[model samples]
Target: MRIPLIAGNWKMNGSLALIEDFGNAFSRTSFLSNAIDIAVIPPFLYLANADEAFEGTPVQIGAQTLYGEASGAFTGAVSASMLKEFGVHYVLVGHSERRTLFKEDDAAILAQARAAIDEGIVPILCVGETLEERDENRFDDVVLGQLDAVMKGLSEEQRRQLVVAYEPVWAIGTGRTATPEQAQEVHASLRARLRHYDENLADNMRLLYGGSMKPANAQELLSQADIDGGLIGGASLKPDDFIAICHAAG
Candidate 1:
């Protein structure tokens, strides 16, 4: 069975002091079991500190984003190799914010995923549809298009290191959430599409349901067959809520 993973996308939030506090809070909490995997993707500036804070704990440290290239003259870009040097275990790619705010295309996201995997960091690739697409009944097309781009040029082995996150654009940080059934439907469809690419790969890949995943609704969402865990947003900032979601996964 694919192990359940609860990942917190800290986005652009948190400072060094706050990260230490968050790490302290996380370390004190008792996990449901070793069956669950927990990760936190803090801002790039805080990665080194977060990595040191989480040392020897079950919680894995990750970076919110990474440059597609290993290293270069890109003034502001953080390369995948650099993240790995800081002991980062996961990287978020194709996040809605990146796609919307920075106009990141699928090809760019694909390159970032490749770089992360090449550097031994797992990529938590985000794929989702907008409110307009959902209203027009074109959600599936949008999601599949995003997935196809990343899947392209990826070998079977490379694909296995990925964790796909379904975070409907309308739901992320909007205080809205896809119902349990709605999330399961899309997650199931995503898995079915993966099966067409490679059955064994599809079966092993972990599909997480993101978008306002909180303590109140985590249990219901986690109980769904296709919904593995969550890529939490606001709730993850709080230790209690994040831990609650992790326990729900168990």
Candidate 2:
């Protein structure tokens, strides 16, 4: 049985004051016992503070991004090892924004995934197709290509330690969400691809649906068989909504 994981990706958001308030509110909530695993990925600067803030709680802290190198003079990069030092257990890699804005290709994302695994940090690898590709009926090929690049140098064990987030590029932050069936179809396809790589790993791995996920539609999305959890965006910023999503997972 796969445990549900509801993760918040606070992309380029939150201040120390906001983090403090969020933390306080989170601590006061009555989360279901081990029903769902809740994680928050804040900006790199606030990780240590978030970790301290969520102390003694089941809420885990994650990083929005991390460099492939463990320690380097790369000037402005936070490595996986450095993130581990700050108690980060998960790292978001290959987000759609990073792909479109920073031009991060599969090779770079794969390297980051490998580095995160080496340092024992779970990498939430993002893969999806753009609206044009979907319209062209080449969505499968696009998503598969992205996953193939990352799976190239990884072993079955390493792959199992990683999580995959399928955020349809066109839907992310666009106020449009893939219908529950649409999201499940893509998720099932992803799981089938993983099964082709390793059956055991595929069965145990958690696949999250990102892109405009919120409390309102969370129950419908979470009810799908292959949809293990979510890689939440805008709705994650609020304490009540995020907590509601977690409860929906239950």
Candidate 2: worst-modelled 10 consecutive residues by lDDT: 169-178
Q: TM-score for model 2?
A: 0.96
Identify the leading candidate in terms of TM-score.
2
Q: How high is the CA lDDT of each candidate model?
A: 0.88, 0.89
lDDT per residue for candidate 2 within 158-246, as digits (tens), equals 98888999999877556666899999999999999888888988899999999688988999999999999999999889888988898
Candidate 2 stretches with Cα past 4 Å from truth are 173-176
What is the per-residue lDDT of model 1 for residues 181-237, given as tens digits with 9 covering 90 to 100? Answer: 999999999999999899998889999998688998999889989888899999888
> Please, what is the TM-score per model?
0.96, 0.96
Q: Global CA lDDT of candidate 1, please?
A: 0.88
